[model samples]
Target: MNPKLRRRAAGHGGTFSRQDAVESGYTVSQVRERLRDGRWILLRRGFYAERSDSTDRPPWERETEAHRLAVHAAARALAGSAVVISHQSAVVLHGLPSWGLDLDLVHVTRTDRGHGRILAGTSHHVGELPASAVTSAEGLPATTVARAIIETSCAARYEAAVVLCDSGLRSGLVTRTDLTEMLGQMSGWPGTGTPLAAVAFADERSESVGETRLRVLLDTHGLPAPDLQVPFGTGPNEVVARVDFFFREYQVVVEFDGMLKYRDDAVGAVVREKHREDRLRSAGVLVVRVTWDDLDQPERVVHRIRQAFARAERAGMRRVHP
Candidate 1:
């Protein structure tokens, strides 16, 4: 048990490789003894994680952290001159949002023409990756933000793709113009249309993945495009509230109420939100609330929104001048 190695593993989400142990003056039997004594946990064939007693973190957070360390370890093991991290792994490395991606596998792209293959726990993509499409992050070769988003969206589901694109745009990791140019460069390539559509639909004003996914659901269901982050007030300097989605034609506001909104001060949040809704209602604006669970049923969500829209339409000719 070298203290330096222990510190390194602690910094790396409690994960270390067999090579790390060996280089730190630990023998094979010593590693086995640590595992047997519950001082360490074997994460994979040659990787080990330090045992911890803390249970404050959620299981998913702990698991994802371990997976990230494994990916980095696999990258070090598969070191190659042409290997550049891409796709979901690149997204993780860049600290970008991704939905429904497999974090268990390390994804890399080779800057040469060859067939993509999965070896051990690493997936290698083979294609022509221009120099501009590659960059370095945290001492690892990885795709640039725009290129990473393009590659990721090409392989992700529509909802996932749109979420990633929106996140990239919102974070300023990639620009809409850059994504559009990347789409043009990827034209005629396999799986380009989906990313193209994602880029076209992406909006930086979307504050979270839930909002982006909700927008996608609305568009997919043929609902009229609602103005995002619409401010409600009688005058420019007297802004009363800014809403998630606003349909001026129907005088409706659709909000995606993510769990985080109430996770911290539930009572205070409820009071503030209730007052906001009341103010909007008093202004003759119908308010519709959606949650993550509601997103699971797109049809039902759209139906409820449509009902709200109809109610607003039939409730006389009152309007709130924004």
Candidate 2:
């Protein structure tokens, strides 16, 4: 690639437009030859992504990265237009978790008077994007994190909305107040209630998508709400352990083991977890571990938790302090 094209591609997540390539001293024929020779991967019409080795990453992560590249390409292509990346596309640009969101097409909202339309792989939404709601992510114009969360929540399902809202809150990129204010601006708009409900349901205490989903499961099953990130210790000024969810009434501690459950030393982590569980058991707290797979069996997981409550009662464990 020419120096100018390389710089442009690097700025836009390895993506470059045909015009960029041509201006960078590359002939149209050269661009076609590069694509034909596997040197350039076509992302969309008039756009291309430089192929790089991504074999070490998981398939889903690789796909998400590709979608991000496409988003950048779309942003660059529409630079002169009166639009900013919004909705799920904005969520991706903000580096938030986008669970259950449709990412096949890039999403953009027109700041001017334009009706919503789908052209090729781009979804153009017509909406009011105030100056406060607009921001730049990685040098590309997109919605602010708070506004993006509300837009995503409005466009996605409840669970997906909760996921985005939880992540947005946890990252400190957005606050509950920010979300509430954004929702206030969307009063009477279509699907505004969904985001309102999602914002109310969102908890920054949820540390992962799986944890957020698990919380939703408990609500869906009508299980008693558990305190989040509850701490336990034998003495004051020291916290021996912090659990994901704690049922004070039942003396049960539910630990969510998601992708970030164990970052290193798997064997040592398992041993340490076992020791921790033993300590909790000795302290009159029954442990119930939940995994990503366990979320798929919500009923079974709820049953197991209820059984733990019964076991705790049989053990005669009373209310304990941290």
Candidate 3:
């Protein structure tokens, strides 16, 4: 086997040993040569990793290679030990925007919990991981894409998971043709794939789902819907400063937030959104932010919006009276 390819194949999240390379027919000298030339970087004492999985990838090129690296390395180190990547790492494999929910921890399980902690970017979560959830990716083990989706997709922007499901379907990662065959193969597995399927088929454009859900709640309550995709100023095409589901006659803007919106990095994104709202407020737009809990309690959300509206109306009335 080609030493470089063997090293790449070792696993996405594992380290390579010298004995494994020699067994695959690469001399220690060859491995050392590659490392010296910077063709491969030493991940640890015995293992090496190539810098790029691909050359000159397009602008949209996903670091799928990086994901591949982590999974491959972990699996090789485990060597038929029956482990699955779970949590945020799995989310990255499933290609979803985790909405700030990522696995800083790498999960693996053995009847005896050792042989983890060799990989740098990995922290160990030792527990009862089933064999069925582990599947082959690039000849190494990884969490099943569906399983990862279930484990990690509970996010602030539900649409992030939805988009991942869509991409998986579009790329044939999951399919109708294999659904029946998987029933028996997946029988003992804990997840049955419904949530992943729901996210996969989520229609952002539909009247009842995704970001549109906010639009429906507003219309149901008789609020004027804001312009979707309205351009604020210009740099990119249709650049949006913030997202508002409703903007009534320049008096108010309604912002809808989901879970994860209140988490740490989201604070920066939220602040940028607030800045956008501030710019609008400077021009007399009153912004009211709504969240999932507010959506769950429409009375509260509606009452708040009504109050903003009333305040705007009172200001308008006062202007006339004055």
Candidate 4:
């Protein structure tokens, strides 16, 4: 890659237009050769990103990063246009988790044009983007975090929406007040109900996508609400441990065990977790652990919680510590 072109690409999220390559002294034939030799990746028509050596990354991570580059390329392509990056594309730009959101096409909303069209892997939306909702992500024009979450919630699945909403709030990128204000602006708009519901259900206590999904799973199953990130202590100002979910009424603690957190030292992690659980149990709380796989088996998860409750009832054990 030419030094000038590389610098140009670096400024645009690692993407460059064909015209940029040409201006940097690469001929049309050379550009074709670069693509064929895997030196360049076509992000969109007339847009390319230098191929990255991401063999160490997992497939999902690589795919998400690639989509981010595509978004940058799309932003450059639409430079000077009133179309701001919106929806899932904006989510990526905002560094929010996209979990199950679609990224097949770049989404942009036309703040100037009244009509929108889908073309060349881009979905143009027609809408009036207020100045407040407009912001920049990674130096590219995009919808604000609050706006992006609501916009995505309107079209994405409820679980996915909650994930985004939870993440936005947890990261302090958007607040509940911010979300409520956005909802107010979207009054009477089509597809507002879903965003409204997701905003209402979003909890900043959720620290990860898996935690948010587990929360939604529990609610969807009609189970009793569990206090999130509950702490157990032996005395004032002494925090012994914190569990993911705590059923105060049933004296049960539900912990979400995401495997990623244990990958570096599974045995040590498990031992440490066991000690934590033992301390919680000694404090008279029955513990029930759930994992990524357990979340998929909703019925089993519910059953496990219920069984813990039954055992607590049988033993007459209740929360005895502060």
Best model per lDDT: 4
> Which digits, one per residue and each the tens of the lDDT, describe model 1 over residues 260-280?
678679999999999888877
* Local accuracy of candidate 3 as per-residue lDDT tens digits, 66-93: 5445555555555666455565566555
The Cα error of candidate 2 at residue 314, in Å, is: 1.7
| Clashing residue pairs found in predicted model 2 | none
How high is the CA lDDT of each candidate model? 0.81, 0.87, 0.54, 0.89
Candidate 3 — worst ten consecutive residues by lDDT sum?
201-210
Report how far residue 86 has shifted in candidate 2, in Å: 0.7
* lDDT-superior candidate, 3 or 4: 4
lDDT of 4 by residue, 149-211 (tens): 998888888999999999999999999999999999888887888889899999999999989
TM per candidate comes to 0.87, 0.90, 0.44, 0.91
**Model 4 segments beyond 4 Å from truth?**
1-3, 25-27, 55-60, 234-238, 318-322
Worst 10 residues of 4 by lDDT: 313-322
Kindly report which residue stretches of model 3 are placed more than 4 angstroms away from their true locations once superposed.
1-16, 23-30, 53-55, 58-62, 80-82, 91-120, 126-134, 155-159, 169-201, 204-322
Please give the TM-score that candidate 2 achieves against the real structure: 0.90
